[model samples]
Target: MLTIFLSALALAVQTTPVPPQTTQLPPAIPPVSTPAKPVVEADLRPYVALVTDLGTITVRIETRRAPITATNFLRYVDAKRMDGFQFYRSTKSWGPANQLVQAGNRGDARKNFPPIAHEPTTTTGLTNCKGALSMARLNPGDATSDFFLLLSDIKGFDADAPGGDGAGFAVFGEIVAGADVAEAIFNAPISPTAGEGVMVGQMLEPKVTIKTARRVPAPAEVPQGCVVKAG
Candidate 1:
């Protein structure tokens, strides 16, 4: 009986099934760094002053937000591209006591520099509000040295969506000082049946001359985020 029981126990042990084995996976590799988006300084906002016949209109170029656009504008300035350009057009009646003044080559094909990339509000988060400085572009990425000064807060001009007419204009800075000068240009007389489309009769009869546009350090007295010249 002991021999039979021992033989039965040995048989039961042999009949037990074995569990399936799993291979250990190697440690997962970390993801590669993205290449399209590069790191840029987040706290560098510079200023540039436009000396016009009316007065000096200083704009705070938003380097942190719109680096490409700001750099493009500075390229034109450093190259003395807009020295002789003028505020040639103003669009009034869009808003009461407010308008947009267009300044640049005044349709001079010879004065334009190479067009820069379009920095829409969608990318920069900058809006077409009062005192905003925006590049005047016919189509996206078609803006050269021409820019506009907003006299009123116009949300319609701000970039609401990406591509297909909603990309809007590339606003790089704002009129920190000499808003009075901008207002003067806004109120300047317009020609009857002279301009095309919405710009009809919105052209400044005598364009305000821009004597110079240069980079200047901001004074300690003025606001930090803005730029202005002291008397």
Candidate 2:
């Protein structure tokens, strides 16, 4: 079970004021005296297939709790614009076991679209467990499309800070398949210029490209919750 500290950090990524609905359908008419159902942490069955130079890894994401973040990611996947994007930032020298591996080029000033709000780990009720996929951001409110996959279950990131609620990173998805493939990327030699000070040379292969990120419709009626069952 996820601890309160971990859950609090996950919610940080919950979109503030909530993003305008991504759906095209009209909003549900409010019923007089009917309080809105409290939002629950969602187990989004949204799946992403990352085709990297080494191999492919499939991830099942939870969207119920982090709807905005999930929707934003699906938008990119649907657009088929994730091809050839690179994981420009790799910070392995920090954290336990030098455990972080981040990737997201959808925010490159020249290649990325407009930025999205920061999704702190707190708001989502998720945690930085092993193989967890979290968004990468320079600061709160600047996230675009970059993300990081945890090699080790680092709990230090599971909290909200004053500036961003410590909000750490938003973990919206988990690697359901191809964990070995992810590790291949994590264990790949770190290049000298993968990231700035301390993180430099932390990339497995500085030139390793994500190649493509495709979205496949999840199986129908999958349970929508935050906890991922062991595969």
Candidate 3:
């Protein structure tokens, strides 16, 4: 979202003799087409379980909408690369209440893979609501394996306006179970001077270790649409 690229192409034109006089007609205006809203078919989704020391959190990924983001996360799960990962950062200082526990590789360059494209909420039709799962990226198409869980609704993360951060983080999934566990990690102890800048006091003192992550069956009672209902 923060990056932009421009390319120019040069075309060669040959001069030709013209007749005495000729009439030219103005070009016809092209018709405008409206964009159709994307549907999140439940059948196209896949689920994963984050087995952490706190507890197990089941997540239902919206494969139909955030395919790249969801697939990027599943690659880590299938490769068993998420094992021993830790929720190293907790941004309770972000608001008056503690919300969300940040995890993934925790900034280890070796653990990172190629980043995926930025899928804005406007295009995906997925809101940054409570229990929503989103991809973390430095810029558009820079998201790799790192992600976060929303403990509450935060629509500001969605595309702010025409030129917003490509409509915020790409929400690929949502928590369907283990809300208590996510909350526990969100409220875990933090070091006052650990994280960088404003996130200093928000970093967890003892990072919560992710015991294991594996693919699981999608919940039978999942509500239709791209978002996961907060457990």
Candidate 4:
């Protein structure tokens, strides 16, 4: 009787049905990404317009990088001391064609201000490259009103440049527009007997006159191909 009861209980327990269990899971999250920053460019360089007999040549002055030289050039512009200036020299035969054209107060002491301290390329990080606007000096710190515009890269004018004086010319600015005008000035007539020493054959016969020079607003955008890099 006990064996039969135990067998009956086991058969009843094995035959009985059991319910299944289900678990709840949380939803998966989507990935998030960060946005990229926009690029911003600003040209805080100062601009100056030179109205000459040939045409207007716009120059961008590196005031921040070459404060002393830039400020000295601006002093003459602000005082109208450069009104009657002339581009009287062209060194097209120096090393390469279309080398440079120089202009100033023609060494008139009355029109020139006191000389400023020398600003080397080591200090300003500028160079005597194409379209460069640099001061003319017999020696460092003697540049007064004379300035020149280059039409080709002349590394010899840079401080520590190979085969050059460690203290080179100070390049304070560059031509931003009317490079054609500068070229015309460079190709102007040269007096065979006007200048002295090495400048004898480099003097402009009739000299291109500068009508006015004044500050102007920066261009909406830097002209294409108007890139300048520090030396």
Q: Top model by lDDT, which number? A: 4
Off by over 4 Å in 2: 1-44, 88-90, 95-98, 106-108, 161-165, 217-231
* Count of steric clashes across candidates, in order: 0, 32, 2, 0
The pairs that clash in candidate 1 are none
Better of 1 and 4 by lDDT: 4
TM-score, candidate 4, is 0.81
lDDT of candidate 3 at residue 221, scale 0 to 100: 72
Off-target runs (Cα >4 Å) in candidate 1 are: 1-43, 161-164, 224-231
- Candidate 2 per-residue lDDT over residues 12-54, each given as its tens digit: 7674466676768889988789788999865437788989887
lDDT of 4 at 29: 75
User: Estimated TM-score per prediction?
Assistant: 0.73, 0.68, 0.74, 0.81
- lDDT on C-alpha atoms for all candidate structures: 0.79, 0.69, 0.79, 0.87
RMSD of each: 12.9, 28.7, 24.2, 5.8
- lDDT rank, highest first? 4, 3, 1, 2
**C-alpha root-mean-square deviation, candidate 1:** 12.9
lDDT of each residue in 1-231, candidate 1, tens digit only: 999999999999999887889999999999997878777745456778889888888888877778888888888788887888888788775656447889887656777778888888877877877888888989998888888888877666767743447888778888767789888888888787777898777888888988999988764454543211122
Give the candidates in order of TM-score, highest first: 4, 3, 1, 2
Give the range of the ten consecutive residues with the poorest summed lDDT in model 3: 4-13
